[model samples]
Structure formats: structure tokens, C-alpha cells
Target: MSDPHIISAAVQEQRAAIVSQRDFENLYKQYAPFLLRVCQALCHDENLAADMMQEVFCSIWDRRTTISVKGSWENYLYRCAKYQYYNHQRSLSRFRTVQDSVFAASDESDDSTQEHIEYRELTHNVNQLVEQLPDQCRKVYQMSRGEGLNTAEISKELSLSEKTVKNHLTKALGFLRRNIEALFAFIFLIS
Candidate 1:
């Protein structure tokens, strides 16, 4: 691999100009492998590392208009990759927490075996309902209820207004409540 500083300098010089697709491709060719290695080290999965790299590049492209290269583009790219990696880990952690809570709640019931099965089913149904939500609403709900983040935190993290975050949460809860009611009615009818 050539010196990263050389590539970084080239990118920095062109940072103020409009990034053409050719420039973006050149940047990707130079940085993707390095960023992939960073992601793979954090995730320990090749496919996930590649996905993360793609996401990072996509993010860069999306925010290209306002992007400012301060010190080193290499460092900035690594920071973006690291942030994405931690975000993925946080999502996984939240999922595991949900599973653990479901088991714990079920275990406390008198009919543990039956309760466990019911709890699993309820969790599955809730997950499906969440997946059906619009992208922003689903993300807000996950960051709030799933990761236990406050509305202000979610707003900052997602670059949304606090009111927007509240609206998404409200929308998600309303959708979930309606679906859950229907699901319960169907279950009762079947049982």
C-alpha cells in the first residue's frame, strides 16, 4: 500500500471542491481496504466489516456538501468507521437485553414453561411490528425504548429535532398498540 498521507493530502486538497464520482471512486479505492480492516478488527466478521465500510462511504457521500477535512482524512474516516462499529454493537446489545428481559419476566411467572413460550411469541410479534414502522420512527423507538436513550439524546444522535423525536416515538407506540390489540384478539379467538 502507498503512503496514506499521500492519499490523504490529495483528498484534503480537493476537499473544498465538488466531489465528482471519479474523485469519490479514487478516494474509495484508496481508503476502503484500510477502513475495512478497521471495521473487521472491531466487528470480527468480514461481511459485517464490508457492510460497515459501504455504510461509511455512503454517509460520506451523503454529507459531502458540508464535510470539512480538518486534520487527516484518514483519521476522520477511521473515526466514522469506529462510530458505526459501536452503533452496531449498541444495537446488538439492546437486542440481547430484550431477550434477557423476556426470559426473566417469564421465569418469575408460576407457569414458567408456558409463560416462556408466550413471552417468546410476544417478543417476536413486537419485533415484527417494530420492523414494519417507517425508518425514522423505528430508529427513534429503538434508540429510545430499545437502547434506553432519552429523547434529547436520540435527537442529537439522529440529528432530529426533539419534537420530531417525540413524534416518532408517539407514532411508534400508537402503531404498536393497535397491532398488539389485534394480535391479542386473534390469539384469544384461536385459543
Candidate 2:
């Protein structure tokens, strides 16, 4: 394979080169293998890698007469594949947050005994973390989270100012967040 820097420099010296059909085919033949490997490594999925590689070549072919590379031809193609992969990922735009996953799994995977046990264990661990909070913070958290009460409702029920309830909830949540991350990792591993 020719060095991309040398090809890039030569093309630059000759001014912008036109990518005719023959040039496009040669470029595809030359770079497809390497580009596919790069995409495969980045995506970690063979089908996705192939799709990305095909998109890169197809796009180049579509814009054969107009597309211009400012730097190395290899680098330009690589960036095209990378951009296509990212665009595909962004297009998914699905919600996969941990809270959604954990809670959703409990409702959806009831057939699995193992999952139920894991959920029970996770619940127990979370309760333990909640118990470790200060008395007022723990009470505020229980009212807000366990009782599904809003800030105003909790304030009225506890006979405390809204701001004070908010502060307690914040402190309790922060403490739980710092502690829950490790437990979540363990659940993720076993599940």
C-alpha cells in the first residue's frame, strides 16, 4: 500500500484531483479491507462494520465527481466510516438509563427466577444504603421516594419548609448515588 502522506502530498501538488469512476473503484479496492477492519474494531459488530464500510464507499461513489479530500485519502475515508457509525448510533436515540433498565427488568423479566433474586438483593442493598443516611434525610427520602410524594406534599406532611425538605432529599440522594454506583456495577455483572 502507498503511504497516505505521499499520495496526499502528490495530489496536493497536482491541485485537487477528480475522482472519476476508475479512480473510485481503485480507491474502494485499495481501502475497503482496511476500512472494514477499522469499522469492525470500532463497532465490535461484524454486520455494523460491513454496513458502515459499504456506506463509506457508496457515499464516495455517489459524490465521485464533486467530493474532494483535503488531506490523506485514507484519513478521509476513515473519518467517513467513523461519522457514519456515530450517525447510526445517534439515530437509535433510545432511553437505556440504569433506572429504566433496572425497574423495567423487574416488571418484564418475572419469568426468570435468577432475575427476581437479583432484584431482591439489589432492593435490599439500596435499603441498606438508605438506612445509612442521617435520620432526617432518611425520613425525607422515604416520604419523597417511597411514598411518591412531591416536594410540596412532603413539606406539608412533615410540617417542614419546602426548602428544608429539598435539602434533606438532596443530601440523601447524593449519598445514595455515591454508594449505589458500585452496587449497580455488581448487579450488571451478575445479570
Largest lDDT belongs to which candidate?
A: 1
Worst 10 residues of 2 by lDDT: 90-99
lDDT of 2 by residue, 41-60 (tens): 88999866766776677677
**Which parts of model 1 have CA positions greater than 4 angstroms off?**
1-13, 109-191
Best-matching candidate per TM-score: 1
RMSD of each: 14.7, 18.1
Give each model a TM-score.
0.50, 0.43
Candidate 1's displacement at residue 5, Å, is 21
Q: What C-alpha lDDT, on a 0 to 100 scale, does residue 25 get in candidate 1?
A: 77
Give the per-residue lDDT of model 1 (tens digit) for 9-119.
787776754367887878888998899899999889986786678778877887767777777668988999999888767756655665576567566777867887887
Model 2 CA deviation exceeding 4 Å by range: 1-10, 13-18, 94-191
